[model samples]
Target: MSANFKVLTEDSQFQSELSEAGGRLVVADFTSARCGPCQRIAPLFEEMANKFPTAVFLKIDVNQCTSAAASQGVSATPTFIFYRNKTKLDTLQGADPETLEARIRQHYGDGEGEEIEDSGVPGHIDLIPMINKAGCECLNESDDHPFIQALTSAGGYLESDTDEQLILYLSFNQAVKLHSMKVKGPAENGPKDMKLFINQPHTIDFDSAESANAVQEIALTAKDLEGELIPLKYVKLQNVMNLTVFVKNNQNDSETTQISYIQIIGSPVQTTKMSDFKRVTGKKGESH
Candidate 1:
């Protein structure tokens, strides 16, 4: 329960990590030490812990922590449960590594899947509410192509009817350090070049994007468009308030462009919790 991956022997430790602060995603594996499938999937599960550095990975032995397993409705060995902000998102039973990995990437990003030491996983804070058109022009800007749709729904997307480029302005509710980003869409019509301008003016246009000083410009490949986590230069994205992404063009010289999903992974510059607040008294001298 202390490391990125941990064994939960008691119910107390299990509950504590489940409710840990800062809106983290927790993945719990319920297994019996004696089960053959449980034994088989152990290494793959551990590899997932390393792959998802930002998620809390827990392996609970049903025999050791019976209360925890029963409370979570785990009746079978090698069951997996995903939780974020104390709410259950999804669950998987048995030791299917492909399904498990896909589920993890669905909630998190698809970073380099290699198993490495946990430097840490970036927080996946939903930023759809903070988006603004700024200076964007799209031929199809109706509800069908709502910009916010691309940020959340994996199946939903925003498309440009007039041209191949689309611009979006993201102003976070709080400052965040961007670690990585994932883009998902059709292969041929997917983005090829993306330019990021940090804390820039909202009046940025297609022409302005060419002249404006770019913090980073990424030459995206097919792998990136298919939901791979493209890690950004970490140092350049510290304390970011507003970000601008200018999609230059698509892989194919298509007249229209499509983006099914866009995900940002980062941590807030300062996280304020309601539990940390206390009422202040104005009339201390007159109060009884």
Candidate 2:
């Protein structure tokens, strides 16, 4: 076993390892001493442990830790499970070396592995500098924890004043192709059940935002609140000049929604102007 690989003998140890993993990818191998396939793949598993230093590699002997195996539904030996942010991503049975390596690469590759699907849109940048600060407003937000603080300053946060809901209206200096957004806060109070609108002429209220059609709606998970970039609908946000984010509720149904940090990721769109086009006169010709 490599230095990164750990052999778990107790259920408590298994749970502790997962808790410590936090947002990192964890690959757990459930095997038995008697399993022939497990022995064959042990070398490759150790190699992967060494290769992917950022990930957590764990081995749990089913016979030694029966409770741990049962909790993870590892009825068959040589079962491999992948987890991230305390969520089960995938499970693979049998010890096919090719399949095992592919699964590892899919989650955490050598250099190019990514959790988000490739949106094909390029030139993504932080759009904070382009924000029209004067045009931005957050309804139902506490005065102490203002919207500007959460949007601009580090470690600053915004909290709801009245209820769990919050409505944020933000306009930009130029049109942008919005790719994704990141919202960070406490898992319990972080925004969930979010609705996004684009190019709204006026600030949206709770009732109107709920009834009106939204470009996209998302139910945020705990992992999402951990500063993960949530991808937006590329087609709908291609030409967005203004954006409205509505927090319909929060995780755990908290009394107030709170956001510590928010980042908009996309590229600015360059529109053509009629003035840029010059009318060319035909050179003085003898005949038309």
Candidate 3:
């Protein structure tokens, strides 16, 4: 029961450490100090490590420990890997919090071998949803995005097993890429900025210039939103119902023109009124 982090120098050392992990769990976080996305999610894994102190928590710096990283096939920062009884269970290659969390949950389950925790939702954050509905009027963006019927609440969601994409053609005062993709969220007086979390579960406020988000910050108006805007952009999804898309009015704004509705239509991506979403989904007059 140790949340210990060790830097491996060679493949043999890494193997020895893995075997030493016993029957507990091994969480290998392959990261470097220079990775912005790694910095964003480092806190999340830290929190999980802390939450389950009985496991082996390691932070392998890919830059310094070349041999170990190369052996593990880790060329990127913030790669989370799992091993049970020295056997690899799951591997998360990107900085996608939702995807990472999903993989971790799958590996950890309720307990490792014998230990058990009664907490229903273990080591996962509850993020608000932006578009909370089932079967949006918007057409299916990917084979992954589907209407989740067993959710505690229905919303625009993608199954954890799916690597699908959904494009949200909405207008924001500012738009930036989380890593390299173009995505938009509430800017100006719209809503609180999304947080970049990892091990310790931290948040980068809308105004803060943090090491999170690898790509340069660009201003994407309605015209800038291209490709499929993933639901994972909003929530750190693990389960099908884990994705949330809720937009509440900013209390500080005096303008009555908050977000009336969230719509996705037309080429590339288009921002339409909420009425269209409700009319299309037959959810008119209902609040998210």
Candidate models: Cα lDDT each: 0.69, 0.77, 0.40
lDDT of 1 at 264: 69
Better of 1 and 3 by lDDT: 1
Model 3: lDDT of residue 191: 27
lDDT of 1: 0.69
Q: Which stretches of model 3 miss by more than 4 angstroms?
A: 1-13, 112-288
For 1-288, candidate 1 gives per-residue lDDT tens digits of 236798888978888887672355678988886788888998899888877787789988877876676667666778888765554545788778998997777555323222212113423444332233343333234456767567565457888757788887776654667877778888888888989888865547788887777889998888788778788877999888888888889889788778887776655554333244343323211111
TM-scores of the candidates in the order shown: 0.53, 0.52, 0.36
TM-score of 1: 0.53
Q: What lDDT is obtained when candidate 2 is compared to the true structure?
A: 0.77
* 250 Cα displacement, candidate 2 (Å): 0.4
